[model samples]
Target: MSLEKLDLASPDLVNENIEKIAALFPNCVTESSKGKAIDFDLLKQELSDSVVEGNKERYRLEWPGKREAIVTANLPTTKTLRPVREDSVDFDNTENLYIEGDNLEVLKLLQESYLNKIKMIYIDPPYNTGKDFIYKDNFSKDEEKELLESGQTDEYKNRLITNPDTAGRYHSDWLSMMYSRLKLARNLLTQDGAVFVSIDENENHNLRKICDEIFGERNFVAELIWQKKTGSSDAKNIATITEYVIIYSKEITSLAFNQDEDAHDNARYKYKDEYYEERGPFYYDNLDRGTLGYHESLDYGIPTPNGGLAFPNGRTKKLNDGWRWKWGKKKLEWGLNNGFIEVQESSSKDCGWGVYYKIYLNVDNEGNPKKRSSPYKNIIQGILNTHASNEAKDLFNRTGIFSNPKPTNLIYNLLKIGSNENDILLDFFSGSASSAQAVLKANSEDNFRRKYIQVQIPEPTDDKSDAFKEGYNSICEIGKERIRRAAKKIKEETKADIDYGFRVYRLDESNMQDVYYKPQEYDQGQLDAFADNVKPDRTSDDLLAQVMIDWGLPLSLKIERIDIKGKEVFKVAENSLYACFDKGIDEEFAKEIANDSPLRIVFKDSGFKNDTAKTNVKQLLKQLSPETEMKVI
Candidate 1:
């Protein structure tokens, strides 16, 4: 049999890695109970004009648009924040969320609701130090399709595997793992939003390139060089001293930076002149002939203070470097009036007939007066391992488990520059959970409502290691313990009603999908008829619940079901929700459902028998329930 070439541009490339097995290869791909992979062409037809495309994949996503996206001005509501337990991941009223899952999958699920909503994101992913086991994520198009079609949904649930140095595809492995996740994470940032990734030398270079590709090169803010340690090691050929924090923005023009004014250089103000203000201190800086008022012939066309012409040599001459307005006349007048200007004293031999303008401590907060000459170069003072060891000892009540945990101050200072109080900070490769500690400490110090979402795979700790033997079996357990300790400490210090709690949302099999598909044996016609509505492992209700959770809707949202002309219709609120997942929807049932005037109505794209029926249903619903919004599931 001849093989047909697949369209390279088509999304089929996403999961078609497996080679052809037999003549019936296409039919071999089956559908899962959760409906993981359906026909992309069909989905595109259903969600026209709303599909978001990347280099190799297209995601059918929608949003409420700019009207609802805008943060409107309103009277500040009298609200006291609290840490309430939410059974689902909506995060609901809380500003922060703590989700315990593989960030890759979580980020994919978040693409719909959180697209362009995040302002700033901070993540400390695995450094790939060659020792640290990096995540091995290989979710491909074929695997996804197979999982869906077979009604077997555990396909994506692979255990974390170590990427050893012997692995030839180390860079490819790390890139593949990060590529899709970063692609999804990019959607969550606003146009002007920014992201900060923390990495050591191992993958810093790679990360910079990846971020440039994802966020665009011009949008790169800076690659900060932070001294994470003070001491030099004697073990290696060259002592590595710093780690880089890569920063990028969704839109370069939308970036906002807090200007940090530098301390005045006291050496520049050492000239002897007596003047001090009560409010603060003051100093006199000298002016040279090149200053504004120098050549009287230029502005006033008059003579110099020594009595001849304004220009030197008793004749007009060009000013040095054609300098003008070191101090304009109006500013010069103000300086003289305030006793800030000083002409050469009467008896002084080196009296240069030029004017001096006062540089005062008080200056109006206006235009970019001084552009930063260089990036921030302050070497962050990190805590010694002794200090870190002691802190970890206290947390574990013994010698620490991890050897080189970063200090809390190092992360706190980095966070201070980019993160605000209400930001949702994510730490995907949260080791020892120092980032979490920094977030809590910063929140308490400033009373900002910043929230943190940390994800660490349950990689088992070494059984021979002291940390594991001490009862922390996995790295995740240590991470959780660190968070608990950090919260307790923060609570003790701040008497405010701050929430030191975080909800743990772990990655598990989706409740809607089951492992295996076992359709009851029946006639070919019967199988075709029932297959449209009856899933092998999951029911329609399960998929609906998953959709609701993914949309950030509350799980406790009351669901009501009603029967209309032998078809089941689900209503979430009294008159708010109306979902008809029932395939082969009769025309009369559709009309009856429309007459109820629900706020929102959802129907599976395949539910209607034909395009004419779908059109009629949409047309009638608009007339009867004019205010109701319609959505295709």
Candidate 2:
């Protein structure tokens, strides 16, 4: 039996949406010339409670390139990630990933492996300051001089098409760029996940509108004000100092962030008792409290230290009370039996006693320590932009390597709020790799591991900058070096055991040749001209990586190169998948792999001796590893 060829491509969003719609309303789905499609007229009628109005005026955000941007999100990319072993810290073991590529294409490739897996996403994208370039520039294969002359890139071939105010479609272009990426990003968030975006005044309002449309207005969490600086002296009317960090949850009902850390004066809690070991320390307060209402049950008396009866505020009579004991009668008795209530002697009063209660520093409620946390405030301060620049300088040991890098503390704070032990954190527009440093630091502090995936475009640096002078030619180079250096520093200072390694993968064209995808357009003789389906320079590692992505397996999974009787084979995540692309295979090789019993396996079609050998190999696997799903390239 001829094995099925593995479909090496990203998830087709259009088809996935059709299947989802069909599951809800089957009659709204219909067959189109291309494939399965949603019948819009039927879908519209099914969604409406009354007669469907096809073209009524409604509230919706629109732009010139909106339609094209929506199409881009639904389309699959022809690119794949190729592993970079030399740059990777721990390629074989680490769960963290540092991907280098255009984030739009990278987001598409990750749609399958990371669908509903990422717990938190924090992106600091281009703020659209008219001088800043957007990420929508498409790179072409022209010469460097030609690209520079056409204003598509800079001297270093950096994708730097600026969107100045003079351009007619200024906001439209920015919206289109953000709209498509946000649409793709939402699918990757877990049910309890959320995304945070930072923006300045230049495009804050526009970004809010886009996020509202994408994440739904009801799911909007908070517009946190980050005091980026002390003040901007260059401002004409008012000094600008704050920026907005908009947040939205995937499902508002399911998500809940951690409360802020405890903020209290330790000195106040000074007194101690026998229970101080668990309760920390204590302070005393008057036992009597003014009543909000006249509850006669609460107005009770207590026996003093001098063997005297002490009523509420030393009142002997049960007058219509404006005062009462803070605790109820049962709770007051429990406190008296415990070491919580304090009765002291007085000179003049007939009761001759003072009643007070002990409050513990670490609260002891029914013999349990209360959780130490407070509601987090929406206004963030003190972490300034200068701190971010200073961090870059400290890490690089040189100035001007990067400008306006986000402070690692900011991400550390976000990690506390949004992540827990072993939760996945992602930052697509990772600059200077501060988020990676933050995750590493957070893990070290608590010894709770959290895996992170960072994505960035390799935008080149200016020649005059200190980063370029130090041989860091691109932003990705600086970002990667930051992680390496930061990991060492964190390990030395903190002496905390944590995972400080990450796998590196660079985006590139697919490993397959043109004929592999377009065999129908070529004659059999023309197809015969190509020696193999894969490209000439591609290696077994390259094919394995792409195959894992196509099979919806993570790139960070543990991969082992097992030698099966001189044939090179890759066993991913201990038999979740097994692949051998080497040639010269027979039933003996298939039987060896079948003995291990992998859940899924793939091989090169040309690996077998002949058609007869391929048929026997499948038959052997059927008898030995019946559960294995076999495919070929």
Please give, for residues 220-258, the per-residue lDDT of candidate 2 as tens digits.
998888888887779999998888888999999998787
Off by over 4 Å in 2: 30-32, 137-160, 262-373, 377-379
Worst 10 residues of 1 by lDDT: 72-81
Cα lDDT for residue 603, model 1? 71
TM-score of each prediction: 0.54, 0.81
RMSD of each: 20.3, 15.1
The positional error of residue 207 in candidate 2, measured at the CA in angstroms, is: 1.5
Off by over 4 Å in 1: 1-94, 139-156, 232-234, 261-379, 382-390, 402-404, 513-545, 552-633
User: What lDDT would candidate 2 get against the real structure?
Assistant: 0.83
- Provide the overall lDDT of each model, using Cα atoms, as 2-decimal numbers: 0.57, 0.83
Which digits, one per residue and each the tens of the lDDT, describe model 1 over residues 1-633? 111211111112123222222122443344668432344454444446766353344442222221111111111111111122343223333334545555655554454446676766777776776665555453345566654564333333433556666778766666656655666678678776788787788878778776777788899998877665566868477788778778898899977654332232222334443453421333454433332334443342223455643322222344544333344456556666666665543243443344444544433112113443232333254444466677787676787586467777766766666566466666666777777888888777655676676666666778899888789877767877787777776776664345576555555454321111223555567556653432445456654544444434433345667888877887775776777777776567667887788887777655777778777777777787788777664
TM-score of 2: 0.81
